[model samples]
Target: MSSPTLDDAKRRSTEKLDPERDVETLELAPASEYYVSHPFMRKLLSWGVEARGILPVPREERTDTQYNRIFFIWLSANFNILSFSAGSLGPAVFGLGLRDSCLVILFFNLLASLLPAYLTTWGPRLGLRQMCLSRYSFGFFGVIVPSIFNLASMCGFCILNAILGGQTLASVSGGNLSWSVGIVIVSVVSLFISFCGLKFLSWYERLAWLPVLLVYVVALGIGGKHLINPPPAEPADARTILTFASTIAGFVITYSPLASDFTTYFKPDVPAWKIFWYSYLGLNIPIISVQCLAAAVVVAVPTVPAWSDGYADGNVGGLIQAMLRPAGGFGQFLTVLMALSVTANVAPTLYSFCLSFQVCMPFLAPVPRYVFSVLATAIIVPLSIVGATRFYSTLTDFLGLIGYWASAYAAVVLMEHVIVRKGRFASYDLRYWDSPRKLPTGLAALGACALACALIVPSMDQVWFVGPIAQKTGDIGFELAFAATAVFYVPLRHLELRFRPMV
Candidate 1:
């Protein structure tokens, strides 16, 4: 059956055109195209709010050629203090030294970024948001489960960025400003930028890298003397190393759902390999550089009595403050800039979260995407405040949890592209996106996903619970999840096409 959306027919007509003729354009959708057709709301255009939802972009409207922005999009999103803080977890929490933590960050982060890079190429060809693309594999209804999971992951990312930004803010303010206040400040700015939508976000991200890169370089220079390979605080066992590696993998892999969200307006003729490498390098450069530097600094924390004390008082933020303490007033200035830089991270997560939310509940598609951005900020502020209480534990636990489902979901999509669709561009068939009757029932995809999630339970190792297999093998749940999902999905999909040829 066809979706009851007001523009379904318009979308169906557009899908008949050659997708390649459409080149890059990220203009704001007209206010009348929005779900609520009011006269005054047309003024929203003056405010620059992007009104586009899950609908595929038509060929005629695709007109922008600034394809190079794809690199800056991901680079700015990840190159922030939070990425630095994630690396510090290795030395500060897991007891890994410079050698081990850097190794894990290098290998796993590069490995995890590959899938998201691969998915980026789909945007110019399909003109659909990442989650919208999933309807082909999971059908209309079944796509909600994975979309919901993606929402949770993006929310978790926002919360993490807010808390880190808040911590940095509080650290710079000494005892005057509260962490909660910092969270509200960061959340507010992020919400404002996201409400402005894609054009403004793209412009902001393109330049965000300069300031963040400057601060990181200053931080490295200030702490350069302490970058040493200190002895591990405790023994580094296979389980602990595996868990650390997976956490790093989880951080990069989390971007899979939002991969195509930024590239939907690129010209289809923009070489696919350019999209892939730009995206891959964009993610790799910041994550590896910041995380590795943070790890090295944390490894020397024990040797510096002041830094150790700072870590004791403030966790990640405290450690950062202590390192910058030697620089005095100038350091405080940089700290505040570092705190605000988190908006770079928050903008993309908030923007994509709204899209994913609409994908989950289609009824909300008529509402401006910015309205959901406001709602998401409201939810995130409170959670960020609460999660700040146990920052390290929350970081690890949340990463592990999201990694489980993200890995499984990504595996299914990759398998569908290769085995079922045979890596052909035309196989996506945008007309089928909202038509459930023409789509696969999604029973096989959902079944495979459910089985993968279930089997991974036995291999899960988290602070709240530990599985029998995980106790012996460590937290290899992400690895198990990807493997299990691929194995189950291939056979299940084969049988599905056999029984239901039209699907």
Candidate 2:
């Protein structure tokens, strides 16, 4: 109390140290000697050291391992596409009349999926994690804000998936198992597997694709026959086309936050074209196929409504019922297949969520990482059970709200690496996780630009705003939002640089 020495002050701030604790328990190496001696730091590091195997090694050494390349590509391709339920729902909600909707889907896919792969390839070349790399755009400390946002978004989606999976389980079981029970069961399993870390998830990915492929093949085989014979087409409309395009874009962009998480494992030596095509084929092609199939099925089956107020909105059950109409007990078979797909999908969602939350720790504490993963699953599962529909709707809005910031992050990184800094950062600089200075001005400028863009973009399209303005306008909210964010950030970034010196 009289006056804590500088050592004491540093010790308090550094949570990774503990002199009284056994050295074996500390997982991470201390940042400084003071950190090594502090009790809290030691405990955290000890846990991190034990769990280090779970994390991808800093980028340079990772390329030495062959499993890294194969698993990374497979995982990136499979994760979002496997959870095809929502993708299936997109076209049904938006009428299929506008041929241009497909173009929108393709464009958004390139922006959300391809752009991030390119950015993450830089990660391996630089040997850094997503949040660490983000310092180029969001300032050193500022990156934390977006990191937290990304983490929350990932967790929220996990909860949403749990809800969807749970509802599927409940429907398949003829309501013998409530959606709540399904949520708990799936969440617990996902938590256990994810706690084992990336290697287990990678293994899951390899095998999970088999069932996903089977389901798709069966759906297409049976459903394709119906399309060939051709049922009368549903009347297409302009509004429906716009809705379809927007929804598809929203779904693709929402998952863009997880892009670097998968690609970080790719070797720096992997050619850009190889990565791009591999990702495009593995991710987008599969997704578009599923979306188109879903649209076709809903259109063909007039009895099944595309949109519903409850948890039964064009679910896998509906897909099976539509596709396998002539076959007996096919719904049950398809239900099982859907369950398998959901399990595969949930594994990576939880795994990525765990990695994101780990960033909030002082350094690399694995126990807390596992604990948080499980805790997140537990929290999300129950909420999802009671609030599946509500949660999905809320999450959709949240993704739309935050997507502008993510887009800005992507733009800033491209500018810094491709234009201003000319991609000159050292690999070791990323590994060390230290900034050249306490703040990064270029990154701050980017964040400010992003914020301004979000505000102005939302204002232009009255539909995005809730008050009298949105009521006066209509559904043009997203178009206004996207344009506003994009246009402002590029120019403001340049002007801000004129006033401020580089950090």
Candidate 3:
């Protein structure tokens, strides 16, 4: 058969696209080469494809101004409202005595939120995706280590979030509906939204925050009345405060790896200060505020009613209902709003998980990124249905574990870009994944850092060598892991390069 023309190839590729197909197997070399070779043609194609939803904004669309890039980064990072809502558990589990708890949250938020900007800014400047950027640290084929790890983590997160969304739905509907049904419903909805791609996801995220804000206001308005009338208060202690602080730290630090994946889309024109302020204010402040409110509610009403023998079964919804009950019809409206807000929270979580997976498996031949996203959602929904509760329990520990690895990965990247090479490396060099001449020191550093972090993580669970620290400090193992990785890798990298120069 004769080689297919460009138009024929495009037609065949589009025709063969399947939602269930694995994107890792897609054959896109011809298309990729066509765009790479023809500069003017590539710009036209990019606009056309992006317009039709087949392509994302090309690098050329990015503004070179620092402020513009920062704004985009801020929007991307702040868009995920789930981060704050999930983190409410920190104060709930640890209680408010730990004044340091807020500090820990602030520190972790700053680190995870800002450091990734530095790494990802390099990506847009170089015009590469996250996985491709890993080539600098992980080395040609070595990039697969982070890629595979990230893919697994993303899938696991999708399942975990689906499970949470299902549980929340089940709680609101009362025990008449099974948890499995709720999980399935949530999974299907998430899958449908994700299958629609970034455009739909972006619109949903922008609107989702509105209901979340409404729920917060309504819940607080009602809950505040209850606080004024005042039930008996539980005495706060030192241990409680420590745990709370540590938990906040753990929650924030755990999200560091995921930050870069979002901020990579920022226009280069965005300023760093704008990115920093918006992320700190728009993202971190709102999130922490929610957590504080949740903590206050738990404190005010120490005894959470058990529905179906589960603690806090109705606590969240009850808070909303209490607020709505005062409004009568308005209250009912707020209740519905609360439910929708919960579902909206899941949208960004699922969307981000899909994007991370797409980056993780860029080598797929037949399936495209959107298809992989849909497939991921399908897999997550079923898992959530069967194991939603158990999955929820595992999320804290699982994120903690992932946190260690993510911190290690971040440490390696920071050391390489900021200290080791002083940011002198060429970004385009990442595309040459087969280069054998490069030192694999970055991969080695990451491995060593991961091992160190793994060793310390169990301590955070009140299990091993440093159980007392975790028990006393909450699960601030993330801080320990991040500190250890940076300290170890930075010096180790220097020694490795000096002792064994790559000639």
Q: For candidate 3, write residues 88-150 as lDDT tens digits.
A: 454454444223344545555655555554554453343345554555666645556766666
In model 1, where is the ten-residue run with the lowest total lDDT? 22-31
Candidate ranking under TM-score, highest first, comes to: 1, 2, 3
Q: Please give each candidate's TM-score.
A: 0.93, 0.75, 0.74
Instruction: Give each model's whole-structure lDDT.
Output: 0.82, 0.52, 0.50
What's the TM for model 2? Answer: 0.75
- Ten-residue region with minimum lDDT total, candidate 3: 15-24
Which candidate, 2 or 3, would have the higher TM-score against the true structure?
2
What digit string (tens of lDDT, one per residue) describes model 1 on residues 1-503?
32234464444353254545422232324334554455454678655668777767655455558887888988998888889888987877677868888999999999999989999988887778999888788877888999999999889889989999899888888889999999999999999889888889999999988977777778778888777446555667988888888788889998998899988878676788999999999999999999998888777877889888878844677777777777899888877878888899899899999889988997776677788899999999999999898888888888878888889888998999988888876666665666777777788889998898777998888888889888888888999899999999988988888765533
Model 2 CA lDDT for position 277: 59
Please give the TM-score that candidate 1 achieves against the real structure: 0.93
RMSD of 2: 7.7
State the lDDT at 120 in candidate 2: 46
